[model samples]
Target: MTGPFGATSTTDDVLAGVTLTGKRILVTGVSAGLGVETARVLAAHGATVVGAARDLDKAKAATEVVRAQAAQGGSLELVALDLANLASVRACADGLVAAGKSFDLVIANAGVMACPKSFTADGFETQFGTNHLGHFVLVNRIAKLFAPGSRLVNLASSGHRFSDVNLDDPNFEHTAYTEFGAYGRSKTANVLFAVEFDRRHKAGGVRATAVHPGGIQTELGRHMTPEVTQAMIESINVANSAGGAPAFAWKTIPQGAATSVWAGVVAAADAVGGRYCEDCHVAEIVDGEGLRGGVRPYALDAENAKALWAKSEEMVAEAF
Candidate 1:
């Protein structure tokens, strides 16, 4: 309803006084950066968090950090996940199902950005494959385990403004791939995933949201080249100099995680489904800002979201 908790608001700020005792939250990409911060804050607020990472060792390290920061009786555990691989996603979900665990919140936060053109083991474009399809299947597979009143948040990005999904060639089979374009498509898919998921689940008391965590320097950029990173920095500096960047932008990890935490645990968000959020509140439609740092029309289009859902189902039919 209001602007996201201000750019400076940390996860701790948004989660203050929010008690999640006995609540089960599953957070992907929890080995580092905002994911780790999000898990730590949730656990500190009394949630039993299952932190999923691609690497068990990294997950262990992240759990240690969360455990150290946890409130007296809060808890954090780790599970292995690889969003790039369907087999891996299936294994992760199957493991959770086998453990008879259910979740109150599922944060689909793991993502790859601007990496070189690649493919998942199943031969789908790496970005679209990992960032979208994998999460799609994972969420659907675990949907039955999601309790009523549960929330799902996908970590979408302002980068989605660059491009919409190419329904004609989503797998890049017909056209040559570009890094940013693929990244944009993947991000757009993230929002679309939420859009369609809400349409199907809101009536069932399960809600979904997509969030653009304001820019924070995180490992998400590790795949970028030094030159590309420099160019991005210069562009941001120019924008800042020109008064384009938000005054309260460029968050610390804690700050970057605030919006997701708020969306996950706040009672105010109970009825707020299928919206793209930023800061700590629902985001406005971006006409001008969409090109800079907001959700694009195509990304949030309900029709397009449904279409993409159908396409994803076809692509991963066997896996699901």
Candidate 2:
């Protein structure tokens, strides 16, 4: 469905004519890909952007690139954040909170994709720990830093269609681990986090939304081996064939960042909080294996979201 923007829209297009004077934003994973572009466009529009990355040196370099793109009155800075390590997450969040800074928008855009099985320092499966739980803890602890009308944008994925979250065994303590399965569960958790976070905080004028930035060639896919990549493409084609849906194509990096930039800054997005978005609009809810487009029903379920939140709280209690 068409909206103010379309699938080919870029961050600059979504943000055209919008002035972000005095706006304060935090964008994670600014070292490359959509995060860098997202930060760059926002900064160029006159916002103060804090670009978070695991490597300060890299982020400092990246921030220069973003700074170079900034228009008059725009500014960009770098912060260190390593989502996989709870201590790192705590230090980063604490530093910001201690600085008494408030954010108009916080984009949880950093994440890892399907990779060979591994665990975070906290003993969570790497994908679940880093992609979902890491952001979960960071956001919740810094919830107070969100100004009224602030937005939290979680970068979920259409690959969530790979599987529903298995909360009981989210860490794969019992079930066999598959890379994509873990990735899917984590992405689903991103949406569920938005659903529950929005429900709890919307009345206070804070909102959360999850976005599936259309696929683009980025470092996020560095873990994909040739064989795995081929299998993934084949699987998508097979599913599309079965569902009578056209195959999907990769988007340019700018186009890939469009929906996220829209969700974070568009006034219309208030009406779609707790929903999954793509192509700069709220996506439909669909069931089955087809990858054409749409969020899985389970991703937005209130109960599932609530349960996941509770479990997350337990998991991160000590750190928080």
Weakest ten-residue segment in model 2 by summed lDDT? 311-320
Q: After superposition, how far is residue 177 of candidate 1 from its true place, in Å?
A: 1.2
lDDT of 1 by residue, 1-320 (tens): 23346667888778766778889999999878988988888888888989889998977876687898777467988888998889999999988888887889999989999989989988889999999999998899898999988999999988887789988898888888899899989999999999989989989889999998878889998888779867766665665556466433467999899888877777365545888988777777765433365567888899999899989988887533
With candidate 1 superimposed using the best TM-score fit, by how many Å does residue 189's alpha carbon deviate from the native? 0.2
Please give the clash total of every predicted structure, in order: 4, 0
lDDT of 2 by residue, 241-266 (tens): 77776776779999999899999897
Score every model by TM-score. Answer: 0.93, 0.95
- Candidate 2, residue 281: Cα displacement in angstroms equals 0.8
* Candidate 2 residue-wise lDDT at 74: 80
True-structure Cα RMSD, model 2: 1.8
